[model samples]
Structure formats: C-alpha cells, structure tokens
Target chain A: MLQVFPDLKGRYGDFGGKYVPETLMGPLQELEEALDQAMADPAFLEEYHHVLKEYAGRPTSLSYADKLTGHLGGAKIYLKREDLNHTGAHKLNNAIGQALLAKRMGKEKIIAETGAGQHGVASATVAAKFGLQCIVFMGEEDIRRQELNVFRMKLLGAEVVSVSSGNGTLKDATNEAIRYWVANCEDHFYLIGSVVGPHPYPRMVRDFQRIIGDESKRQFLEVEKELPDRIFACVGGGSNAMGIFYPFLGDTSELIGVEAAGKGMDTPEHAATLSKGTPGVIHGSMTYLMQDENGQITEPYSISAGLDYPGIGPEHAHLFQTKQVRYEAITDKEALDALKLLTQMEGIIPAIESAHALAQAFKEAPQMSQNETILINLSGRGDKDMATLMEHFQEEV
Target chain B: MLTKTSFQGKLTKTEDLFIPFIVAGDPSPELTIQFALRLQEEGADVLELGVPYSDPLADGPTIQRAAQRALKSGMSLRKAIELVPKLREHGLEIPVVIFTYYNPVLQIGHEEFFQLLGENGVEGLLIPDLPFEESEEIRNRSEEKGIEFISLVAPNSDQRIKQIAEHAKGFLYCVSSLGVTGERKEMSAEALAFIEKVRQYSQVPVAVGFGISTNDHVQLVRNHADGVIIGSKIIRLIEAEIENIEKGRMDEALKHFTKEIRALVQ
Candidate 1:
C-alpha cells in the first residue's frame, strides 16, 4: 500500500543500496542526479514517449483470452501483450528510455548484460538506432542456449562477449558487465536490463517499465470497466513484474510474482530467490539472494534462461517482506506445459520466462469465479526460445 | 593476544608504509601465517589478509584465481579473522587489516563480526564495497570495537573525496586507477594529483592501492602518498610460488617471495 518507499539512500526497506566499489560511488551519484533531472524535464519525457509510440509501438494491446477463459471455466483471463512490442519483448521499453538518457549524457558507448539475450537485443537495437557503440556480455552457457538471440545481437552491430565465470549464467555476465562499467564508466553507459542492481538503477528501471501496467490499467478499465482481481507476472530480476504490478499496487488487485522452481524448490537447482533466499548482497544491492551459510553465492538453475538468476530485484524483496505481494514458484515442467497450452489454445507463443506466470494463472484461474478477472503480462515472444524448446521436445516430435 | 590500539598510530610515520595482501588460505591457513611473518620480515608495515569469496566484484582475474584456490581450501571470513591469533603466536606482530567484501561479514552478522575482530588482533577493517554513504553503522560499529575502518577515495570521487576523507579512521585507501584491482602496465597519471587532493582532506595517512603493479608505480605513489598497499602484484607473486609452497618447499618460497616484494618497496 506504500506508494513512496526506497528512501534517499535507495534503501527499499533496507534492501537496495549502492554496495559497489568506491570507484562507482561518484558515478552512481551522478546517475541518480542526472536521472532525477531527466525525469523531471517535460522535454525528456516527451522524447521518451515519442520514441516509444512511433518506433516501439506503445499502448501494446490488452486482449481478452476467450479460449483460455473457457478452458479454465472460472476467471476471465486477459493478456497484456508486451510480446508484440518492438524487439519482440518488453525489454525495449526500458532500453529506449535508458539509451535516450545515455545520448543526453554524451556517452558514446553502451554496455549491457543478458541471459536469454532479449535485453541484449533490445540494447543493441537502441544503440544501433541511436548511432552509439554497443557491447553485450552474456554467459557462455547462455550463448550456447540462446544462440538465435546472440546472433541477433551481433546482427544489430553489438559485440557479444562470452563470460565463463560462476556457472556462466546471468549472474556471471552481470559481474563482468559491472566490472567493465567500473573500469570504463567514464565514457560508457551501462544499460541495465532489469529492476535490479544498485540505487537509481532499480528506481529508474522501474519507472521506465511502469508503462506496462499504465497501459494495461487503461485498456483493462476501458474493456472490463473495473480492475482485475489478480495480476500475474514472472519474476526474473522482477523487471516485467515491477513494470506491470507497480501501477496496480494501490489498487485492490492481488499481485502474484512467480519465480522459476527449476527442477523444484525442494531441490538445490532452482532460481526461487523470494521463496528460499535469505537477506544478503549480490551485484551491488542487498536483496533476497540464493547464497550459502558462508555468504558464498550458490548457482541457480532454471529452464528459462532469463529466469536463471540467483537474486531477485530489491523492490520484490521489499514487496515480499511487506506482504503487499505474494511470491510463488513454478517448476520447469509446469511452465513448459503452460507454454504448450497457450500456444495450442490461443495461437500465442509466450516466452518460457512468461510461461511461469502463465502456469501460475492457469492453476489459480480454475479457483476464481468466471465474472472475476485475471491479467497476465505476456512479457516476451517465444521465437528466441525455439532452440531450448527443441532440445526439450526433440524425442517427442 | 596482541594488544589492539591502532595500526593508524603504531606503524612508523616517518617512512612510506608498505602493505602486502594475501588470501587467508590459498593452500592452507598455516601457510598464510608463515606468509604474514615473511611479509613482516620483508618490511611490511601492515598485512591486509583477504577472505576468499564466491563473487569478488572489485577484484581482477589474478586475485579471482587466487581466491578460488583459497576457497577450495575452505577459507572464509571467520577463518581469515581467526588466523590473526596464529600469526601473533608465530611471532608475526604487525597491524593486521582484514580486507573482505561485505557479504561475508553480513553472513557472520555485524555484532558477531565486530566481536570476532575484538577477540582476534585485527586492528583495521576494510570492506571495499561499503562506500561512504552506506558505512555509517559499520564505521560506528568498528569504532566501538576500536578497529579503524578504512575509507577509499578513487580518481573519480571528485567532490566526495573531502566528505569521505573527513570520517576516515586508520588511513584513506586511495584507489590508484579508475578500475577494479589488477596489474596494469601503466598507472593513471591523474592518480598523483588525486592523492594530493585526498591528502588535503584526510587527517590520517593516505594509502594508494589497486594496480600498484610495477616498481615504477610503487615509487611514483610512494613519493606522493603516505602508504602503498599492494594486492594483485602480491597475489601474482605468491601465485607463481603456489606450486613450490604446495610441494612443502616453504623456505624456498618465503625467500623468493621476500626478495620479490623487497625489490618493489625498497
């Protein structure tokens, strides 16, 4: 219910703060100040919106899932179609905003990190459009898994550097990206992909992404004439979830964040940070982190490459602690099953990351009455996930 | 137990201070104590002992490899802090500073961590990630245990250098370059003027670190700053001798290590 949180030091209930090296302090402060000034300027906001509407296709449709609703025989389901946005995912929303800021700040080079490479592709697209050099860091393992997305980033003229440390996943890529930023922050801008990292990052990323919920709210109100009973969004560093859930926080809708259960939460192989993680620091912020008793970060596993992270966003940590939002875990099989169901039933292929939230909605939709409504943020298109899906369904086909 | 008062006060103020860093258990904690003694004998005024962590963000590739080796030997913040008493017993009496990332300390809990420092002979504490803004509680907690909490000022910390240096306890840890800890061919030429700015604000001694790789870097920084803290170079030197130390050739490694550090500092 709290609208204004994350006090001046960027502490979202003592969760988010700048835990970076001394070298990054001044730069972070400058970023915060610059972002604040930019957000306050009407010209900046106008330009950001102009790019979003004309280029990336803003007001992404909120379509009624009639077949899904009839299949469930309970709640009427609606999909917030972020998957239709430019770059084929919601990642472009934040990238466009941050890239504009980079150009405004006179930064010529942009550095980014990715897991499924959606964010990398988005950053690369914006950098190419804006005529700035782009460098993207991705885990070696991810590069192998998300080959199409990796190639797409390169096709956009971004250099894709493979990181091989710490399970060679998003966490490792983020570490390499931050290290590079620390070294070259004087000339480069770090275009973060999610609602994670230190201070102004989580805040600015959330603001840039809040457009999802804003558009959904308007569209839903126009159609249903009332807010949905429940909102579902997958939590991978919580960018899409934060984007869709933030505008509805003050509303009566119940917010649910679904995390990747990987094999299962019972097993060590899962990226269920909000469910199993404890309070600790990772990637320059104090949040719910999957780490051992000795404070060593443990590797997380998930079928969804985007969701395979050891830590959740600091805002999600705050929301979880405050009990304003409920957090749940969906296993890999359930996500796959839901993806298949959505593809077959509606001819809409959702990204495996978004399928986690889809699975959650499917499970709970049967419980609510038909008059009640459920809105799911279909965060990305599943085209990039074909490689991963084929590997899973090869024998079946 | 070694009496704890101040590395800030006890170390020689007349000459430029030489500080060498090594992971607590690269092979074993026993070797770390021996290494500490060797560094002390080789004119190390302060010993900055590190704890192996899974993700060390500020460290470059060289120290990361050393940390991985140390972690394989089960080195932790508790083990790193507890090693101080062993060093004292082995007749290695110098100002011991625990250099670690914040998560390990968070795992130990702040109260227990400070108590451990008090119980051991740790005179100084440095968490590179805890910048000036987020370190008030830690600074106060360290002061409660009489451990001087070191503050770091980087080349980019334009106006904040004064605010940070004003509260600095033992010595201001001046970053010699604009990046993570590594061995670089050339030091940032602006580092000289940066140290001068820090000196103007800091009441305590200024120790420059992060890529003090070559002897030229050491000499250049030594003339301008009160102390020179060497991390990646020492890790690199010890890494070269890891095979010899693992083979039970401690004396040979110690002699080689001392000669190597002696060249840089002297």
Candidate 2:
C-alpha cells in the first residue's frame, strides 16, 4: 500500500514531472502503461531477471577492500562490484530492462543518449542481443574524450550520432535523442541511460537499477550479517547511485551521493548539482540544475566525462531536500588520487566516475572505527577511462 | 482584458489568421521591437515571441540556432517579458503571445509570471513543454490574470485532443507534425487528419504551427485550420537578412518576407 517513489503523477515530492513536449506525452504515457503492466506480469519479470542473471551477470560480488581499508586505518571498506557486470558497468541493468520493455511493447528500434559512452555501450549491447536497431546520440566533446567506448558502441552495431550543439555534452546529447524520439516515436523506444528524464523513466530506471542494492543487501547480510554503516556512490545523473541506494532507502545506512566538484565548487567549473544548483526543469524533469540567474542551464565540468552532467536526478533532488541523502563534492584531484590509491592498494582500477565515490569513502573511512563498515558502489571498470587516466598520469603511466 | 474575441476580430471574412513567431532578441532587443512593429504593419494577425532558453527540447535546428543567437545577445525571461510592454508602447495592437519553454515560467513563480504577462499587455502564452496534465496551476493563474493560456495538441496526442481543446484559450495550437518546430517539405496526411480531429472539439480558434512554411503550406493549412503560425522559416528569413539589418537596412528583408506570406495567406 505504501509507495516508495513517484506517485500517480510521477513525482517524488515536488520534483519529477513529465515536462516534455506534447508529442512525447503520448509515448511517455504509453511507456508508463506498458512498464506498469510489464512490471506486474510474472513472465516479464522472470524474463528480465533471467537476462540480467544469465546474460548480464547479476549478483555482482561485494568484495572487502582489505589493503585499502588497512591503509586508511579506520573503518573497514567494502566494494559493491558493479564494475564486474557485463559491459563493465552498472548501466547495463537499466539498458537491459528498458530493452526488454521495448521488446514487449513490440517496438523494434531503440534510441539513447550518452555522455561517457557507458550507457551507449550498454544500450548497444542490449540492442545487439535483442536484434533491434540502436542509435546513440553522444556529444562531440564526449565522443572525443570517450573514443574507446564510442568504438565499442559502434562495434556492437549501434549508430553513434555526434551532436555538436550547446557545449556538446550530455545535455545536448539528451536533447538530440529526445528530438529523434519525437520524430520517430512510432517504432522506436527511447532507452534513457540515467534516472533522470520524465516521470516513469526516473522511476523505471531506479526500479531496474535497484537490483544492485537488492543484491548488495543480500550479499552484505550473508557475509557481514548486517548492513554497512554507510553507502557511497557518484552522482552524474544519479542512476548508479539511485540504483544502489533505492533498496536501502528505509534502512539506517547513511546514503552519501558524491558529485564531481571539477576544479572546485567555488570556481565556475563543477557538476555539484545538489551542492550548488537551484531547482529548475531540464531534460523533462524538475530537478536541481546548474543554471544561471536567468534560468539558462550552465555547462558543468568534471575530469570524469561520465560525471560531467549539470543536473541531478529529480529523486536525488527530493532526497537532498528531505535530508534522506547527504551529498558531497569531490574534486578531480581527489578522485584521481583515490583511483590511484585503489589501483595500487587493492589492484582494482575503477572508472574515474566511480572513483568519486571512493574519494568520499577514503575521507570518511579514516574518521570512523574499524568495526564500522563503509560500502562504496564501484559503478564501472577503468578500461573506458584509460585514456583519461593516461592523460592525467602521463609521466607515471 | 484581452480574450479570444480580440484575436477573432483580427481575422477578416476571406483571410486565415496569420501568426508569425520570432525569437525575441534574435539579432538584438532593439531589432526584436523593430521586427514586432514591422510584422504588425505587414498584417500579422497575432505575434508569438519566443524567450530563448538554453535547452529548448521542442525546437529544431533553425529555431535552436535562433535561440542561440538570442541568448548570445543577452536575452533572458525578464528581458523577453519586458519586450511585450515595449511592443504595446510602440502602438502594436496585435495580440502578442509569449512562446517559451516551461522552466523560465516556473523559475519566476506562476502568479508572478502571469502577473508580469498581464502587466506587460501580453494576451496569450504557449509553452511547448507544458502538456495538458501539468498545466492546471498555470492555466488557472493565467485565467485569473485574464491572459489566454494556449494549449498545444500534437499529432501523438490521441484522445486527449478533446480534453485539451475543451479548455484551450486564445486558440488550440495544433502541432502540424510530430517533431520540434521546423520547416517541412510537405504536411503529412496524418497531420491533416489530426487537425480535422482537433476541430471536432475545438470551440476556440484552432491555429496550426510547426513546419508550416511556404505559400503551399499556408494554403494547405488554411483549408482545415482557422490560423497558421510560422516560426522557423521566419527566423530563417531574419537570419538571411541579418547582414542587411546590420547595415542599417532596418529589417527590410524580413518586412518583405512577412508581406509576401501575408499576401499568400490572404
């Protein structure tokens, strides 16, 4: 009887409404209906879980960071290994779910927008598996920064469209993808990569990604016999964090969302939406967005291309407003240091985006007692970020 | 107070109401006023002025470029709202509709936004992003302020067309196509059927927009709709005449283009 999120109007408190064009309203409504029916259908749920388990590798391990924990010399740290999932990140969870929903709806084409190419790769992977046509809109700047993942998307037989508008980042890619969907909504299902966008998308993405937390809850309980004291995840559009945080919403665990504080929050550069942004609508949702006084969205910066978005998810905005989640900013330098530390101490090279969570955990882990544990969602592997890492650590690597 | 009757008065016995849309502050704020006056002089039935936004999801490349130009010229919601008063002061008597995305209106609270539009002599408002479901509060406030809150009915909006049309003020903005605002080669048969369907429930005047350009488009749209709104093509015309306007020709090219369309629709 108690609903955790998105009431009938698709709102999480005052945030998250369907603020899209009139054309998209029908498609979104159709999607909402189909998703509701699919979620309730047992066979559909079975098929979704089956694909997630047999194909995408669900129940990713929760590994103890013994060396890193020892180096920190305080709280024991554990990693939820979403980085080990097929396609090397947590993005596949939502992609697979949406693709399945698309197939059930009898749609044969899928469209998506990606900033770091992780979502694009995941969408492309699912499309390939399902034998559907896939088109990915990526910012030109993101395409240049994330070349390997771009290639990966293409290799998986998805058309990668280079968007060159409005700073050519995630926001622009999303705009392009939405535009493409508006024109071609008859046969295409828009596979949104994050827990942002209009109503059902944020809720649906959270639903799909919640498996991370569900598995983590089970795995942690089986291993440690209790919940961790804290959970940390990096927030771009807040998909991975929302995925890992949803199942623990009612739990006593302290949820911390780490945003990319590029350069610093004080400077003009950063993607710390909850920390610095004001509530405004962007990409079909009213959320905390980095915008000017005139309500024009401002460009956000981060060394991690995946974490370079200017808006936080509407649910995260609600969470921040309600004090359900504490958000912190991690600078590029801090995230890089944490990435290097994890690679050296634990032999796990995390994606730069996921390293943001590690950065926050490293800071907090040192302050607590060793008996207290902190769980960090390692949302992706570092292979896609190798070029960025090499560029940053040119002499060292 | 301005109402749908005020707009109906502009349409002659033999003419389809011609509504022209332009991004406010496209070349400059000064040029925006000049264009508004020129459009009225060129027999525009109604004027739709767009307040530029950073993310206009419902707009296509041409309009997007125009918005970028307007933003580059320092256009903001406040400035765009201020332009309405200036148009009234300039003795432009046509009903001016503020065409914008929803965020700016939400940023400035609904009461204040409608009040601002009312104070500035703005007769109507069109938010492409604000669908019928999310428009109640704003629509109510706009009605209280006596500003016609225009509703858009898209091709994809199936049964909701009746609901939207029942409450549509000023006019029902019938989106001629499925995508963002742009010029198209030909109007789809589905769009013609969509307009016919919307007409079944539309008590207010039905004005079709999006991809409506050229004499052929105007001629085709006039057969089924009460009015035709032109946006991207007008922006393109302004863009084409930008060099001339900068050289002190004073939007002669745009004025000529508007005059030509006025003649075609008539």
Candidate 3:
C-alpha cells in the first residue's frame, strides 16, 4: 500500500544513485523501467510471491529470546529468525527477487560479489535454482577465510573469481564484480548482495526484503499487541538492517544498527565507519566511509566477516544523517562474547554478523525497562563461521 | 605558473600533445614525489597525479593494487595535497593536477580543499566522480584559488558533450570507453567519434583517457584528440615489473612505458 522506500529521485536522503559508468547506463535505465513495469504487472508480483513463499521459505518465525533477555536484566528481546531462510541469512530474500526480475528481463547470466560468503552462497544458490550460469567475485582474503563457501559455489556450478587487489575485501571484490558485469553487461544480471551500490539496487533490495518488516509487524501486533520499543540488526552492506528497518522508518520504534568494531574503534583495523567516519563515497553512492585524504580505501577489520566493509549501505547513511536510526559499534571481543553467550543460553549459535545485534541487545537490554520489547534480526545461524571461530579460539589459547 | 586563461589559451590551439597520468603514492606517498619529479624530467607535457581512492571503481587490478600499497603506506588526501608543497620545495614547477574522486574532496570541505590545493601550488583538479552539472559549486569556489575544475566528456548526447566542452577548464577528459577506467588492448571507435565531437565544440584541449594504454592507442587517439591520458597501463608497467617504485624503479618503468607512447607522439 505505502509506496516502498519512496523518497526524492530514488534517493534515501542524500545517498543512493546510479553513479556508474556509461556502459551500464542504458541497461540500468532499462532495468529501472522494467522494474517499474514489473511492479505494476500482477503476473510478475504473483510469480515473485509464489517463489518467495514456496522456494525461499518466507514467513520466518519471530521467536522471543526470553531466557537470554531475562539474563540481560531487562527488556524482552525477540528474534526475527531470518537465519531459518533457505541458504541462510536474509540475502536470499532479495537474491530470489532479483533473480526472478532477471528472468522477466530475459537475462541469462547472474553475477555478484560477497563479503562473508553468505550473500555469494545465497545468490549462487538462487542462480542455480533459476537455471542460470552464475559468476561470483570474492576477495582473495575472503576466499581463504570462506573456503567452504568457495567450494560450495563451485559445487553449485558457479564460477568463483578471486579478486586479489585493493585490500582484497568486500568493496574491492564488488568493484571487480561491477567491472566484470560492465564488460559483459549485455545479458548478465548483477545480483548485488546487499543494500549498497547505485540507485535501483538499494531501493529494489530494500523493497524485496521489506517483507521482513511487514511480516514481523503483523506478527508482533498479533502476538504482543504493540510495536517494538526498539529494532536491532548488524550492518555490513546492511540489507537485513534495512529490510527490517525500512517498514519502521517512520514508526516510533527506535532502530539501532550495530557496526563491527574489530579490535577496537581507535585502531586502524576496525570497520566501524559510522562511528569514526566522515561523509565520503565508496563503490557508487555518497555515504560515510572510512577513507583517508587522497582517497585510498582503508582496510576494514572485523571478527565477523559480514560486517567487515568500510562503507555502509546508502539508506543507513541517510538514516544516520537524519538521525532516524542510532548506529553504534560492537567490538570483535563483544561480538565473540555475545556469540558464545547466545549459543550457551539460548542454544542459538548465531552468526558473528548477527552476534553484533545480540551484543547490542546485551548492552541496551540492561537499561531498558522490563515491559519494553526489543526486536533483534537474527540474520544467520553461526554454522558457516564455526571453523573460523574455532581456529581463532585455538590460536588465542 | 600557467593561468587558467593561459591554460585555456593552450587548449585553443588545434595541435595535440601528451598528457600522462601517474598514480600518486603508488609505491609510497614519499616515493610519489620522486615519480612526479621523474615524469617532469622525462619531458612530460602535463601530469595527472592520480590520488588513489581505496575503492577505485574506475580502475582495473593494476591501479587497484597500486592504490592498496599507497593506502597501506599511509597515503591520505591531505598527504597528496602536501605533496604539492614537497614538489615545489624540490623545485619541480610542472602543473600538478590532482586526479581524484569527489568523495575525498567532499570529505575535506570544498573551500578548504581548494585553498590547500592552491596554497600547496596545485594548478588543476580532475575528479571523475564530479559530473559537470554538479560542478558549479566547486567551480565558483575554486575560481579565485586559481584551481581549474576539469570536466569529463562522455561519448553521449551532443548537447551534454557541448555543455561539458563549454564549461570545462584545464582540459576536457574524453573517456575512450563508456565503462570504468582500465587497460584494454583495443578501444571503442565511438571514443574517437566522441573526441572529434568534443574537439569541434570544446573551448579546452581534448584529452582521451580510459583505455589509451599502448603507444599505438596513444597514436590513434592523438590523430583525433589534442592530448592522450594513460593511467592503468603505466601503473601496470610499474606494478608488474618492479617490486618497489621508489628505488628509482618507477622512472625506469615509466621510461619504458613512456618511450613507447612518446615515440608515437613524436
């Protein structure tokens, strides 16, 4: 009913635009037009809804983390179990939608870049399901850290290219992916993993993933009879945060975004952009990013692979600028601590990325009144991160 | 020092020369000064001192790798600007144009950036991210500071091309391809066509960029445009062949890369 992410010129405040090269301009314009037509096309909507519910596993549960919340001393913490989504994490919600849009556009190939490899795994999985050739660009470092995902992508019949340049992180990988897509722009649909990138991407991904908030809103009303006192999620490229944050953009609920502060905020190592950054553009859109003068991309570190990017999604930039949502940094120590506590107390070994939100809950829940409710989007289960976490623990011991 | 009018005066001539690009702080920010001095020593007509962004969406692997090394060595926009003073202190009076994206400029306030650029003896600014339509603020602010805000001319609508040509200061960067900046063996013919269009209407010199890699590419672009801009290829030459650019390897690498292009220019 409400126009999805309606703002000026497809911008989320001061951020978001097709700040791309001329090669992709025509196709991007065409895609924007096609999406407009598809949005109005009932057949397209019907097919999209059908695939979302049946294939990707929609309507994920919003289970309350009562025991964990009780231990934190105050507010009721609810978990929007997006980790239950097939292929893991909230990336699938938009990947399926974009892959379907690719189908409508008669595009044959799918390309994407991944950080923690969750988005790559999800995108490659959807591309396989759609019967399309998939190409994934991952940083060389990510390939080593997320070796299993690389192998999984290969097993799924997708071509995985390791980008070795430019800090070899998510942003660099995304740049390489865009370059690949630009050179091969004729028929490939770039399935951007999150709510970053230029114009239509941030807007489109937010629309598809808005189902998280829509469904959660209804479920909460049905269950608790009131909206959440606060909403929480991890911000990498920040899709899950936006998906869950978009519907409640104007709502009274306080939205909190947790960024990865690897080691600590002061070190050159952390990826806490919002906490220690000024306004700058990275990738395509103008947003807050950790960069130096002369414009060299800084190395962003995080214990959680997903929240390791130096720049956040444009909407988060806008929300942060407008003070609509509060953003804070959660250290690697805090996230790891939260991960273990959630696993021990709730039997939920949440992804380190999601552990950021859990850490936020641990800090904020203590100050919240008992009657107040906090919603934490448990973006993914921690299975993929087990090897890395174990290796980290073994090294520390 | 060339006045904006004097630079514009040079652009009015029909003859084309050479405009070479070098990634500032490629090996290290300290070494970048040496490279700038070396390029000047090597008879470079003009220099595009590329200020490396962390995420250079327009660059290929070669330039990206160079940027990584530079950033790792603590190269900042402030440091790049400071290089102007270092270069001047070293007595190199070549017009140093800061080749960077708009984000860093925006991050360091426009007035301050222009003032620092002017104070440090920077003559021009070539930012790929700042389209001409959104450049009025920068242009107005940079006017008295004697900073020339360079504009890019894409192979697009004649109207937009004309508008860019009219507004462009220093030189009109005529991109050789419609995509991001990179090294390519062959270039789009449409780029030549675009250059011809810009040459016809431009009040400034037309310099071809994006894929003008080899000497042959420069020769080809030279036939139509006023100047040739080569970046990724030169960066690749330095990156691939040498381990360090500072120990005088940068000049040796650039000598080989530039000799190939200069031969064609001659």
Winning candidate number (lDDT): 1
lDDT of 1 at A232: 98
Per-residue accuracy of model 3 over B131-221 as CA lDDT, tens digit each: 5544577888767776778777665434677777777777777766533245554445666566667877777677778765556666667
Candidate 3 residue pairs in clash (backbone atoms < 3 Å): A17-A199, A293-B76, A293-B77, A294-B77, A295-B53, A296-B54, A297-B54
Please state the error at residue A265 of candidate 1 in Å.
Answer: 1.1
lDDT of 2 at A18: 95
What is the CA-based DockQ of model 1? 0.82
| Superposed Cα deviation of residue A23, candidate 1 (Å) | 0.5
**Reference-based lDDT, residue A217, model 1:** 94
Q: What TM-score quantifies how close candidate 1 is to the native fold?
A: 0.97
Stretches of candidate 3 exceeding 4 Å from the true structure: A1-10, A17-28, A66-73, A266-269, A292-295, A366-370, A389-397, B1-12, B25-44, B68-76, B82-95, B143-146, B156-166, B177-192, B196-201, B236-261
Query: Which window of 10 residues has the lowest lDDT sum in candidate 1 chain A?
Result: A1-10
Off by over 4 Å in 2: A1-3, B1-4, B7-15, B178-189, B251-255, B258-266
lDDT measured at residue A181 in model 1 versus the true structure, 0 to 100 = 96
RMSD of each: 2.8, 2.7, 4.4
The residue-by-residue lDDT of candidate 1 on B158-229, one tens digit each, is: 999889988887777888663323555443567667877888887777888887777877876777778889
For model 3 chain B, give the 10-residue run with minimal summed lDDT: B1-10
lDDT of 2: 0.88
Please provide, for model 2 over A10-66, each residue's C-alpha lDDT reduced to its tens digit, 9 standing for 90 to 100.
Answer: 999999999999999999989999999999999999998999999988889999999
Highest DockQ model number: 1
